[model samples]
Target chain A: MLTYFVTETNWLNFISSLVSQYRVFGLIDYEGELKWRRLNEANSHSITITKYRSIQPIKKFFFPVKEEVTAEPSAQKTILIGCKNCDLNHLKTTDSMFVGSPVSDPYYLKRRENTIIISSDCDDFRKTCFCTSMDEDPFPSKGFDINLSPTRGGFIVEIATKTAEQLISVRKHYFQDPQPILLQEREKMRKRITELVKNNNSELNWTDPQRIVSSTYNSKAWDDDIASTCVECDACRFVCGTCYCFILSETKDIWSRIRTWDSCQSAGYARVAGGGNPKNTRAKRLKNFYACKLVYRKENFGFYACTGCGRCIEVCQGKIDIRQSLAKLKKLEKNV
Target chain B: MFKSPYKSIKAELLEVIEETSNIKTFVLKPEEKFSFVTGQFVELSIPGVGEAPFTPSSSPFKTDKIDVTIMKAGYVTEALHNLKGGETLGIRGPYGRGYPVEELNKKDVLIVGGGVGMAPLRSFLLTLLEQKEKFGRIILCYGSRTPEDVVYKYLFPEWKKVKGLEIMQSVDKCPVGEWDETVGLVTCLLDKVKVDLAKTVSVVCGPPIMMKFSTTKLLDVGFKPQNIYLSMEANMSCGLGKCGHCQLGHHFICKDGPVFTYEQIKNIPEPFA
Candidate 1:
């Protein structure tokens, strides 16, 4: 809850100071897309805080697209900036999948332990963003070390953990105690962005995703329009923040084992070695994906797997919109 | 510095028995004493090839060496079958819940296996035999494509000699004079057998289609869903449960099962598939 004021120039200097010790990555808005780029002391000044999350989730930092499971993942001390609340909240699912499982993934755990997350508020909104619909705010309240709230001339840095406090302690000159009016400004910015997200998603209806998904388990919508458009490219799964499925492969000489991202959207995901797949068809596979995201995950992990980032909608190969699928399944008489 | 569970432990192939044309039983001597309960499986690997999950057909009581019965069906199994003997292989696991031996004590245990599905059951059967006096009648009904495709033909005589155990056999068809046993569907044996349905528990393992038909047959023959056990198989990549390949609805087969009761998973769609 402790808030501080860091001017635009002071904030850059503070980030630059840490470059000698930590590998700092900041959001660089370029070519109409916001991407995470490594920051040295020189490039730290060029780091631009974005209003939304990047196309890549924070998971790629922990669970890479491919890694050698046979060796140790580099446990480099690092800091990540420009993480939105949607990006931070998605870790609830990924953390449990990687760290809280019966056997933890060593690579993911190592990276998680070594990284310090600095998330930011969404001063702007994306058309596809629907965090408000999933009971999430545009700003982070937890699962972050420090959160930056963009105000008129600077960022309102809210320190949440001892690590953040200690990290800030070394560069105390860059920060000043926030004025009462600046605190109000941060809250106002948050409210405006939340409203923007809500308005953008107002047209799409399923208030209770859990109920709607369960009721539509046997709906004709799955086999109807969905079957034709779904090419099963697995783009949605690969870009998702919560899809943690992976497959293991051996090197040609068997000297190493590589763990690569695998998606259930693929036909052979649940196939047995003997040529039997429970989710054989595209319809069955798509149903499984939705059931896991909305119903089964909540049943097992006590939370929905979808992060509400709307990345799936953007990256979908077949131009299939999940919102349309829900609308098709929705009965006019019942909200579900 | 935490060690990854994906890494397979070195194990030397001590011996190999050619069970049939495609089916083979491998006896492995792991560098360490790898112990597992009955019905639990291990990820076996052929050095330069790949890994596949299989239940140890050897007795759980035997820790010095492990036995796995593999049919040459896929890439890894094909590589495994090509090995004669005395080749170094890799293994990881002893994952998933094994058979509920404590629950089966003093109760009649009926085992239904189809073809290579008999591999995991052999471990469960051996465990029961070791303490056969502690349980009631143990019945095994097995069916294969033909007499030639039957695995562990050498063990049937030894099993018949054991007290409190009854074994039956069936084949899909008889090729002229190739067979002389029960020639019909395995479900026929399920119908003919006089089991005290009230006190019996059944464990079924086979190919997907066979598992489906046998489960329906068990239900029809007066067996309760809770009493029937099924050895479910999916594409299990990481035996430690992090990789999500072997999911059966909300439960991961590698962690929550490989062994599940019919009552536990009857609700999941295409569970046997």
Candidate 2:
């Protein structure tokens, strides 16, 4: 574990230098919202290089929206910047399914192996964000090549992996040993941001998500009211950082099997042939979606499927709030 | 080099047997030999069309070729039905948990299948027949919509001749013609036969509603929940269980089971539904 201080000027120079060797992708302010974009020679100036998590999730970096699984590996070396702890935590869920299985997903494994992740600590929280409720820090504790903590005029970089150490050694001139005062300031900033997120999500109780969800399976709170608000557009699932369900379709031209993201909210998601649908009703389907995040996933994978990234809330057309829904389920749990 | 679960090996269609108007049995010879235990399924793929999971109806002992009995139910099946012999198709897996044949040794086995649900059971029956002397009495009670709808009708005569085995066929309703089998639900056939409740290991596969009713009847006839096996089918996309389509409660049908004991999944809400 090595720590370094890269001044704002040197950080920008480091980004520019890396562009020649690796495909560098970083968060940029796009019409007020942050988005992940490739930092080319032309767009390098617009790169935010901040602590904000992008609107687009990190999932697509490894598992694209649609990818031909039968194709040969591209094996492109990539550098990802400004990933928050919430998005980085989702890799654990995906890794359990795609990598930890008896049959590993070569596509995901190849991308994961080649990509260098530089996680940034969040200084602020979105109104819908609730990472604290999910027992996650605003700063990443693990699963990153390097973690960046923003401070005045520079960033305190903590290298967590051999890849990141090698990356810094290659561009060692841009980095210097951090001062004691700078390290203290970085810790204080992390604590303040964590407090803000905790205060914002105080109303939502996730102390026992599994217990609450199990008891509230038949709760009327998830009835017509919630069902009516959901248009079944599947925007939430598409935007979710940890949703790994996908449908495979083959193209006539390429003759390759392509895997694309799928949502449980879709009518045909759980429908078998001969018109058998277990989650037939909209309310039932919605319950299953929530249960997957709160209960089912924990039972299967030993962790909640949701990373508390708040992308689902931001993307939902009907303005459905997961925090509010979980609070409601908790209320129903008390009654039950 | 890591082997990907999504990668499909090429399998050439060797023969096509039209069991009924809508149902066809495809016999495929894989470029690389694909072997599977009884009651396991494979994801059959048509190049342009998509893939769907189908249990092999052929015996595991016959590794040279595999048989998949499919009805023209949806888009993938429709595309599969249009294909001719010598055409190449992609095949992945032999996935999911198969039947526990070792547990059935020296025990009377009761197999009940309805309509095209008999496909997976056919494999189980054939495998059991191969080791008939190791098992006790074997009873197969099958039901179809009509007399003409019955699959593997040609094999019934041969199946009956096996030692200590009894085959009974039933049709829900037959056309106004020469029909020689019982006319009623498969559950009705249970009344005509005496089941060794304590010793019989019953395997039931069919439409959801039929399976639900059959399990209730089997229980009423004194079969233990642990002894009854169910072939649970869900809409499966990834046979490797990465796709969440086939999730039934906490269980992934593609991984945890396509076959589960009644006692194993009985507590899960809506196990049949």
Candidate 3:
């Protein structure tokens, strides 16, 4: 790991150089919420890197909400910063789905090839954050070109790729070789934040998510308890970092086939041409979400699709907490 | 972009035959050579409309022209039904695992089809007919809503001539003096199909309910679960299995199978659904 200490001002200068060279998308605090915005020279001057993942999952950059599958999209050299571990980790699920496992999606492959990822350690986490419950760390140990940890008057920049070293540019003189004290501070910060996240999820009843989820397929909670509360606004899926289902829509003239975000919750999602819908009921649709994330994705990716980023909980219109649902599913295991 | 999987090959409409009130067979000549296995399907697209999946009714041996039997079921199919002839359409993918022809070799092959499900079975039957000496026996039991609803009527005579092949058809309720064959569900034909239960392999494709019942009957007669192949063609989008619309439990119906054995999908939740 190439570690360096750059004062907050010099870090801003380095971002300015990056913005001048390539299109930069970084998390910026907007109205008390972090939103990903393009970094211009002016915005780069005051860029505050929030370790919190944006409500939008980083998958949107690679597999867009809507894109023509056959057409070539403009692939610009880009830098994405302020990514949390949740954002970087979820890409593995999406990558395995889109990248060539016999057939590859070119639109997704092009964007994945062109962009650089800059992750940061989460010194703080939202109340709904439960990365610890999902068996993931709040801080990223890898899967990034560059990483940042905030300290008192400066940031400890740790880069893991050659591209990240080149990004330092003329501002390379600004980084001072870090002392041993800096590494000690980073270790302490990581432990404190991890403990805080674990403690937040201390009330979670289950530890083995896969076993609990697979056993709850026949649970009545989906139709009886959960379906009544859900209005099917699709907010939870939209904000989810790992939801990769999409529908192919044709343009008016049918020239371009557009792949738009699709939710399994939609009634038409599994409906056949002759109007046979396998997941016809809202209850079945609700069950499908858990089945895909907790069961299917885990089998395919060898990890749970839910990174415990809590964007689903925060953006949910029905006040449905996934943690509460998992507890309900666990209750099925007991009754059986 | 090396030939996007989504890119459609231009196919000129060569002929359109009205098979039923709502069903039509469009003979398409692809701009380039295209061939698909009997049980595999293609996404046919009208330039101004959209695409829907359909299995080729013609033989896999014929690559110069493909005969697609389409019914007016949904938006895309409605437009496909409206096409006359000589209009160009877009065709992509002969997707999914087609009928395991090799697996059926030398085994008694029983085809059970309902309504337009006969489309793909026609292709499969024709393929078997091309090499008739290889298989033990081939039986086709097809049922439609009524006499008017039955498709591919003209081919029955030609199909009946093949040695070691038997054809039995039924209509739910045919008009008086219009039909002579057995007047019952297609599953009724399974009762009369005298094949070695141990050596017979049955293929079923139909409405969800018919397939469900047919599968039960096949199991009742002691056909092995692995020998009962089912064609599940429902809710497929982006036929490459990436779009995730065609998921049945963990399996993508468009990818892992449009053709799956009962043993492969029996435990999956509502396999017939």
Candidate 4:
């Protein structure tokens, strides 16, 4: 509820100042695609507030792809920016994984404790975006330390919790009381944001989230749905926000053991040691993708693992559109 | 031993019994006494290799010693085979719900085992024998691939001498000069044992395919699905259920089970379907 603003001209400079003092991670152009990359003085000027979720999810910042969760020591501190609401929703799911009972993962705990999340509003929704259908708005709800929204001539800022207030206190002069005109601009921008989200959702109404769970279990539609083009390359899992299946490899040379990110889409993801794979077929693997996203995760963690950021669709070699697949599943269930 | 959160205790191998050509039984005695109920399993770790879940084949009554029979199917078991007496290993549990022994007291017991699956069932049988006066009748139907694959041949004769206990073993194919038991499938031996379906509880342990067929046969013989129990195995990388590797639908085969009743899991797809 504590709101403030920064001038549009000084937005990049403010980010640069934050970068100078912290190990900042900001949205950077990785070969023309927006991804969260390590930010430094040289890269801070090029960082921009993207209108859509990045190609990689926020899990990259928390649960790194190749991190040793049981490392002898642990990881380092970081501050990240330009995260959209869809990304924040996915972070809440990842929190349950690393922080599960009996013991907390030291590696994930270190990285999480040291990282500061700076969430921003989506200035534009991407073409494949369906976050609204997944109950995710472009604006963050509660978990972020600081929230940012763009205004006509500047950026509207809000601090939610003590962590954010402490961060803003580090640079008090940049803070200012809100002028009435600036307050009015934020109200108008919020309305515009809602309208944009509503329109995007209507366009995406063809794909249904509710049916993604109910129909994929034993449907013949999925046999054709997960076409021969799947290739089982596992790029979809790499790009997904909540695909947390991992394999434990013994690296006794360094440590007792290490668990690394494993993709369910891989041929051997569910294979036992003696070579029995329950989800061997592409159809079963495709079904697992839906069940893990819509059913198992919700039943276990009370949240849908998919944020509808459309990264899986963007990265699939098979061009398997998740929205289209869910729509097909809905139609198939209706026929039944 | 008293239970504590993630306690690492040292245990020594008192004896090693070769059960089959590729499987061995490591009898461990902890420096301190530890007691557990039947059907509960412990996490056995070889310092350099990794940890795996296995049930103690020894009786719960004998707290001073335990036996863990392991097949040489994976890395952990391979390391376990190389260990000798006085070698130290780490243990984590007597975790998950053990067999419903309180509910099972004073009732007839039917045990079905195949391959290395006999290990856990043996623990249940030994525990039952300690309370032999409380139970009415105990029947064991065990099967193996061939004569060379049979487990614990030394204990069969002593078990046969136990009053009111009927043990029937079978081999898929018996070799020459090594034959002395009923031949054919384990299910075929079911006809020989007289079980009053309503008064008995049956526990089955085996490979998935064998368990599936055994369940069907038990049902045909009028045993209620709820009266039957099954010990299931999965790749339990972390026995606490946080790892997600051991998930079967909503249940983690590690925590929710390595033992589950047929009625509890019949609806889950591909769970021994």
Instruction: List lDDT for all candidates, in order.
Output: 0.86, 0.87, 0.85, 0.77
**What interface Cα RMSD is found for model 1?**
1.5
Q: Where is model 3 more than 4 Å wrong at Cα?
A: A169-171
**Cα shift from native, residue A159, model 3 (Å):** 2.5
Which stretches in model 2 have alpha-carbon errors above 4 Å? Answer: A334-336, B1-4, B175-179
Candidate 1 ranges beyond 4 A from true positions: A253-255, A332-336, B176-178
Q: Write the per-residue lDDT of candidate 1 for residues B2-116, one digit (tens) a residue.
A: 4578888899999999999999999999998799999899998886688899999999998899999999998899888889998999898889988999998789999999999
Give the Cα error of residue A29 in candidate 2, in Å: 1.5
TM-score of chain A of 2: 0.96
Q: Report the CA-based lDDT of candidate 4 relative to the real structure.
A: 0.77
Q: Judged by DockQ cut-offs, is candidate 2 incorrect, acceptable, medium or high?
A: medium
Q: Please write out the lDDT profile of model 2 over residues B47-124, one tens digit for every residue.
A: 777889999999999999999999998888988888778899999998999999999988999999999999999999
Q: lDDT by residue for model 4 over B198-270, one digit each (tens)? A: 7899999988888988888998898888998999877776566666677787677777888898888887777
Candidate 3 backbone overlaps, count:
0
DockQ of each: 0.70, 0.63, 0.66, 0.35
lDDT tens string, model 4, A96-190? 76675545665666678888888888877776777777767767777788888887667778888787798887776676666778778766776
In candidate 3 the C-alpha lDDT for residue A234 amounts to 87
Residue B242 deviation, candidate 4, in Å? 3.0
Ranking by lDDT: 2, 1, 3, 4
lDDT of 3 by residue, A30-109 (tens): 76578888999788776558557777788888888887876665688989989999998888788888887558888888
DockQ sort, best first = 1, 3, 2, 4
Model 3, B35-151: lDDT tens digits are 788899888888767888888999999989999998899999888887789899999988999999998778889999999889888898889989888888899999998988889
